[model samples]
Target: MNGMWTFLALMMMISAQLQAQFDRSPWSFGLLGGMQRTHFTGTFQSLPGLYNCCKGFDGSSTSMDPFFGGSIRYAITASFGLDMQVEYVQSRGELSAVNTIGNALSFNGSGFDIVEAQSAFMMSWTIPSLGFTPSLAWKPFESGFGIRGGFTLRLQSNGEATGREELIQPKGVVFSDTKSTIRNDRKVNFTPTSLVYGPIIGLCYDMKLSESFTLTPEISYMHILNQLIEFSNSDESLSMSALRAGIMLSYTAFTPARLVEIPITPLPIIEIDTNKPYIPKRLKAKLAAFSVNEQSKEENIVNIVIEEYSSLTMTPLLNFVFFEEGEDKIPARYARLDATDTPMFDIDFIHTPNHVETYLHILNIIGKRMIEKPASIITLTGCNADIQKEKGDMALSMRRAESVKAYLEKVWNVSSNRITIKNRNLPEKHANTQTIMGAQENRRVEITSNEPYIISPIITLDTVRTMNPPIVRFRPQVETDSVSTWQLIAGQQDKELRRFTGEEKVPAFIDWHIGEEMSEGLATDSAIVYAFKARTSLQDSAEIQGMIPIEQVTLHKKKINRVQDREVNTFSLVLFDVRSSEITEGNAQIIEFIKGFVKPNSNISITGFTDRLGDADANQRLAQERADATAKALQVKNKAIVLGKGNSALYDERYPEGRLYTRTVDVIVDTRIDN
Candidate 1:
């Protein structure tokens, strides 16, 4: 009993621990399949009344058997659940005793006797988790496996029993009745009702059947803490065990079914009249220019109805306006126009001019707007004005388009090449006395591509040497009014910045030299100009990280200082390593870092060094190898430099901490030419 409580408490702790790791639902069904072993324990309250010696016998020997069972589960979510199971098991036990008192007066049995018992049984089980259950499968790698444990209450145990028992009642009276007898009992109760607690290890397989339905199969084992069965003759006890397995089919339904919504009906269309004395206010402003060449006004009353637009004069306006109060032309405000945030005459159409006159006329209005808003696209539509117009002919109206183009370039200073002259290709209905008053209304112009008001690019400037050339930066435009800035933010990774833009710049050629001779003695070398940019906060921190090993060309090198700081042949290397000396790894990081530094023609210098661990000769060899290795890593199609200082004293002995300071690489940049 004590062990049972301890095991139950332990299971509770484990369940609670697992519950906190995931999200669990209110109810869950699990299928179980496992084995169980059992042992029997307990004292008998009373023995058979016919047997005097069996009254206080101790059951010294016990036996157990394996069984199969299953459980149904209802979870309250993450912390607790209710469980039920049924099992079929068979068990055996032994008892021994001697008729010590019955042997008096020489009427006694000489030896002690043993009784054996065997039982076949079935039990109903109910268990509740002491702690909450998990809501979700926490370990994906577990492949839908979890652990559960709690205490169980055996509700009912029902089964048949058949066993043989021998008894020694008295020596002389009917000794035959004391012999072993086969007895059969039905529905015998074998186990006591008590809390059976143990650890539960299970695997949960959640099979998605559809959007709402899920099929879960699980197998678990429960270790009983105390023996469930009691001997009919003694107080001795042992642990009881049972096995269970089951499967359940379940379903789920969600509300508010998804479907497509009906679309709203369109508004009714409206018509207009240009010849009417009082024009509809909405259609008048959209017409930029229109004139009625009426030979006789008495009978030829042209009624015009045009569409309304924000700008570009394509809608209702001058072309469809009626002359009221003897006005030569209609004012934009008087015309019925579409009320919009954009004002009249403020719209510009970008065009390539084929007709100069109309082009210029339109440019004047657009250029004035450009002066006010430099970042606006200008559009034009029309042909030369000198072309003759035949009655009811559309193509003839565009012949004089050159006048529009010429006027725009000469007076408004609009580029003639930029102007576009496309004929309106007017259909009679769009212009028939209702839409357009006459031929003039059929000719027109528009503005296109606006440039300016874009955000500046973020620049990353990296240098092999501060003495070399400067870095160059640029950006591309895809369309009007849309621009993304190029910047390197602190601590932001380079790949993250690259997601926004695709350009990067890196330092030029890097060089490495050993001493001064080609094969022996002293050697010197240099690298060509390269490009570079600095890491943005997003790319990395501003504080120096590790060194980057670069290719020779990336780090340009030139002999600037002597071997001993005295006047000597000097070389410059552009791309070189920074914190890391591992030429390969460092080079990879450097190259990736350069992806966001898209600039051009950045000349840098490279200077390589080594630690004083070895002799001058060994140190020189190591330093040259390090520099050369770094240089080869950064070599791209672009010009880069490599420089190697063969242990000619770069760092002092005071910084003998490691190669960190002793084995150092530096870059110098020069900014003069453009590459």
Candidate 2:
């Protein structure tokens, strides 16, 4: 576990270093040549017969001549960095000895000495946050420092040897024929802890260099204890001290890191019936009282029921209401707490946990999408229409819009600075339509924009396989009436569709009759309709397995220039029996459609249209809702430009009641020229 933690910490350190390595700062990197002075202190009694090895000599604390070396620095920001340095140094100490009782005898006069040398590598960083540099001088007030201890190898070189002297009276000297080969010896401390620490201090400096580089000169010091120890015939203790100074040069490249922004919105809502009556059997001892709809023939109140376990009855029971609309206003008069002979009634209202979670999920998706595409514009419309219609007032709509904007600004990183809300009056068609299904489509928020954004996958089946060539279809501007069609097939064949390889001219398969069954003006008046069969093989069975259910349609529109100004329309589908904005089972199918049909760098024109099941204005809004939903899905897939229209102008002479079939989303792809 310790090793694992160490490895994890190392990885985290590397990651942080990489992330911060590119931060913007005034940086300089250059070779530094400077001098450092060191001295020894502490315990010289451990070894005897060595330099500074007298029997009672204390530790020597003395300064030595300065040595030369170099250093390098990488400043991560204006205040922090990694600094490495190395230096070569020499140190020394000495002691004197005295001889006794040789008035007439001869003796040699000499002194003992030891010279020490070492090389070291120290890593440390400077803390500029502790103080600020003076403006006029370009020097820091104070800089903190950190360092790693270094190792040293000791060597002993005997300078002088003392000779024995003869006494004046009656004493004869005896000589032996033995010589010593251990005149000089050295020792190396192998343990890591043998190293000592040094003092770290703040710095003040001035920086100056060429246009692309800079130079910073700094000073730091370290102090070590226990330098003099004496062993048999030798002294080994060594105290350490250093004063270092150097200049640093650096070249900097900075890639800034900024927080991403997310744009969040409120969840679209649809109301369901919450009105019903309650009854209980075995009405013993007036067990509980019930409430009913206040406006109805009965009263709308909370009902409390309790089953009798035995003769004893509990006086209090808990009644909880966990689901309530956010905008609901509970009236105090409606709080029926009656303690009559019949029993008492009380009401409680609360929001379900599921409801809150669902709303948060919607807002999260919006925020994530916004972060991915920061410059995109988002328009919110159509919420609170039902409340306004019911009350015949526009205040509800305004409140809804403001609430949504607030949620986005507070919950998401998106600032109110970028958001724009338009509180539109209810369309005349929705004046009195209140069916549950109709109201479901009415209580929605539509997102829209005019900018051309990509709304398709970066890759597709055609880009991967060759068996079935993809088909490309487009509708020119309805007002311009310059429509075109073409087929891209793999294996050549003489039939309904044509094939094109590379930049060959786009083949035209003119079959305007396929749309004859569609309402006359529905395709062009409100929106354009374009559909194609997925190209399949007759012999190969595995070729079409697991393919997208519908052929993905790519649109290209033409205006003035054939290559530069066209817009591509994003196409999508809405599943039945579910709200348009909710993420349900149908979402997978929507993704498939984008993958099969949309392409990168393609622009689209999406016109929303609805069946005549609801009033004209309501249908128009529903169409817009579908358009907005399609655009949202497509935006996730890739990029696109989307426009929403309400009801189709196309009409049918026969089977006029079947307008629902005509309700569709039209996508026009542009090669160039028109937007």
Candidate 3:
């Protein structure tokens, strides 16, 4: 029993390591259990009372009991493999014999009474043990029928014994005879407790339950190779063996030790067979929550500013509300003057919450998409329906363009180089110019640009037998005349592994793996599959697969490129005098540099550092004061930001040469992205 427990502990450790090794192999594991017939064979030295029990026995006995176990099997090839398992079994055996004993006795005063010993006797033994089995298995021609040959290593056993003895005796006076069965009970704490080994042979059949699940039935016999038990002070030796048969069930799947998941948008695939006619699909390519009714002519009356800088068109999601804001109560910022010298109607830029929300929505989509494709550029061209009395139409249009550009640069962190403001200063050339709708239609900004930005619909499938080849089918909403061509591409890392193309507008029942020519884009180890549809020059990424489940991946390539542009400014740091918030050197140089390099929309941040010779709090204050002084020095300070770091500079007075560099200000600058 102790040896069994020790073997169990070792099995746990081995199982963990084997789990990784067999994860990719076509293998199965099962819980094993069965019943076995076991027996002990040997002779015991004669003892005071039990001498006849052993020496007088002329026959041997065997007992049937139940045993349980677990097993793991791995195939080195299609027909040959290894099976390892641990089992526990307990066996009980009994020896019984019938004998007759009688003797003539001298008489008492009257007559002699006779008794006969004609009864039964029984002696039993129980042995419990843990066994480890390692076998070599063969499954001919990839069939389920298999044969295994191995050895069972038996551990020390938990032993016990019990017995019963009975006889007939005389209990009557002379000339009277009566008989009764006299019995004696026997019990002993003994067992066949020693290291033992035996040969094992078995036959089994594997029945599959699912793609990765299976059940196996087997029967095995064990023949002992050595004596299993010996007495300490008596000349007794005992050995044992067994036979077991049972079923085992197992799964060859991932039993996760730890799990992580990420939500992703799956790109949709359009199955296109150029062989079929093109039809409109239920492709709602409108802005969020709004659909386009082509029959109507600009029903919402949104300002449409067309610019040549970027290629994203603003998807307007408003009713005619912008064309309906009360011109009489226009905010001072959005207000324009008239002949009465009063504010007149114009699309509110900042006053109303609803208008701001719409503005922000458009900006967010445009901004985020632009950031994704940095090569794209955006131009804001402003327009007016009529000239204002206070400021000419050109000035008002320029102001609107500037306001829109500032919002993007400040709130969205759009780079200045990527954005341009072009003032049209012209009224709506379309009919609504004399009406309110025309005014709103003429006052707007246009965005014109395009991965990794998740939208909706993720694709995934459970693991399948890679050996048998798998298929993926999807039900797509293919509205007639909407989608032109659908594209499917599967890839790993950053490379395009495979691509499947179709022009058919019918519902797609496409192969997950197209032929090499069609799937030329896929490099295919394991990767995310993306689906796209072509519309003009731009492609819409409609869906993405979380993972591609492939069996027996011989080579896996993980190429990760983390490109972080770490840039350093060549200009020298500004040095400061002791205990002063004044620029001691390079004041003129910094001013000149700011004038040359910093754009009007650019943001400047000056952080001040100090020597560790003063109170920490006071030094922090001094550093801030010094930064403020430097900000004041710059000719352009409208967007300059400042801070202090006390003694937490890159250099400190911890070493002999650090103090000189501590009292300085480091200028770190970046564009404004208001959170």
Candidate 4:
């Protein structure tokens, strides 16, 4: 018995090591029918102090009986279950004993005494019972092997024990052998135990036959703890044990379904103000322009220098189109051209002085380039921000690249075979990922081409003019709680020379370049008036006017004085990755180029600028560090003017590329010709 328990414990440990593989139902009904082998044990005597034939007999019997039952199992979990089974079982066994005592003569008419040799007694009984078993079942393995343990309750029906006594004589003795039935097959005189209980341990293996059906083979051993019958005359009793083997076929009734929870947001409450009129907020605007010329001492007056020269303007193109976080489609800010509009799209016609505006037509520009260079192939590598909603979103990145690819294929008639699309978490050369602007810049698609001109700088020849005050800085201030719309218009007489508009709060400073068109218009006017208008959402409006004096040199006066024609050259070194002052090899090469353009009479000005990020003081320090580094790298003989402009919006700060372009040190060299 100890060995049996040891074996059972070992099986449990092995089963626990395996993983559950089958999906079991909660409720199952099964029919079980099998054979039970009962072993009976005890010491019994038919008659206590009577003949030695039935005295001091070791009682033992073994019988096999068929039992049929039904069981119901409820699975509490994937591995645990409760089982109940009821069956009708029968226990049948026979006990026989033979012994020889003192010889006895059989009563006969003859004078000879016959010696009785051996006496024997044979007994057989049958007990029918109704058995109920409730057990806890555990299935710990994916192999469908399980174990169950419980107690069995049996209620016995009317049962009886019958016995026959026999006497055997020697051959020499003429006494006839005597045989008589001592007990009939009727009910026994002593009452049997009506109720029996014992512990039962079983093992079973489940074989899944179908989706809702399973067949299991089981074997169990039960030992009755209490005696079945006790001899009234002696201190001896009879007990029985059973080993049952059977198979059960079960059908699943139903399995519970898992429920998913969804959260619902409640609607917000709104109140209407019908008792009072809507009063608009008061709005006020201020406007001023700072001179960039060293000759002009006043802030409102700017000296202009117009020179005639055929120059090639090479605008280096940024090969990335940025996207919003968690978005795959192209933003509306980028200009999209249809197939019908492709013929009318001309890169040469785009003459905006702002390079960012020209960058808005990047797709059209690429398409036009592809049309011109048919052998060129390009790859679009999409990237995600790798944080927040966009973290490790490779699918979204691929979709963004595909979006660009689809636009090119559909609108530009570019062959799909020429374009290759790829995706990754972030670009190879990405910006700082810790900041919001940095993450925004990282979420973009990079365009690379095998042909150089396809992505090279856009070059155009135009009549270039140099201004004494190269930059006209506009300072606009608006006093309003909320600004719905604002516009600053710089005009010359009846014509609008330049206009800047915004929906958000007005920036502290807006810089306007003295381009060819603006310089021509400003040459005729002594002063340029700028009008500032602002309004709130409630239609409360304010307008202000400001004038900047212009020191203009007329064409006839320049011819009389034989004024020397001065040429201006500007070079920019953009720092994209970090805010450090360390100059890279590429920046060193640009510095060498700027050094080559510097003549003895050339006035060199190096201005360092930073984006609208971080503290103003810190930016100022960083900008100064960057400018000093560039000046040291130039190693020029003449002293150069170096200034650090901190967070002064040189370009539109709303775009990532604009922010990147703002973090730069620009070298402008103005040299006069002696003719």
Work out the TM-score per prediction. 0.26, 0.22, 0.31, 0.44
Give Cα distance to truth, residue 208, candidate 3, Å.
0.7
Candidate lDDT (C-alpha), each: 0.34, 0.35, 0.53, 0.78
Native-referenced Cα lDDT, model 4: 0.78
* Candidate 2 similarity to native, TM-score: 0.22
Task: Give candidate 1 regions above 4 Å deviation.
Answer: 1-146, 156-195, 209-215, 230-235, 241-248, 251-675
Candidate 2 overall lDDT versus native: 0.35
Candidate 3 segments whose C-alpha is farther than 4 A from its true place: 1-27, 39-42, 45-55, 99-116, 168-182, 231-237, 254-675
TM-score of 4: 0.44
Per-residue alpha-carbon lDDT of candidate 3 for residues 257-364, written as tens digits (9 for 90 to 100): 443477899989998899998643434321111112333221321211111111111112221111112131212332222323212322222212122233323444
Runs of candidate 4 exceeding 4 Å displacement: 1-314, 459-461, 464-518, 522-563, 584-596
Candidate number with the higher TM-score (1 or 3):
3
| Per-residue accuracy of model 4 over 503-558 as CA lDDT, tens digit each | 96788888777653475556563567888888888788889887766555544455
Residue 506 lDDT in candidate 1? 23
Give the lDDT of residue 177 in candidate 3: 29
Count of steric clashes across candidates, in order: 205, 60, 35, 0
Q: Model 1: what TM-score?
A: 0.26
TM-score: the better of candidates 1 and 4: 4
Sort all candidates by lDDT, best to worst.
4, 3, 2, 1
lDDT tens per residue, model 2, 528-638: 222222211221111111101222122232222242332232333433222233333434454455455444544556656665554677766667776666666556324
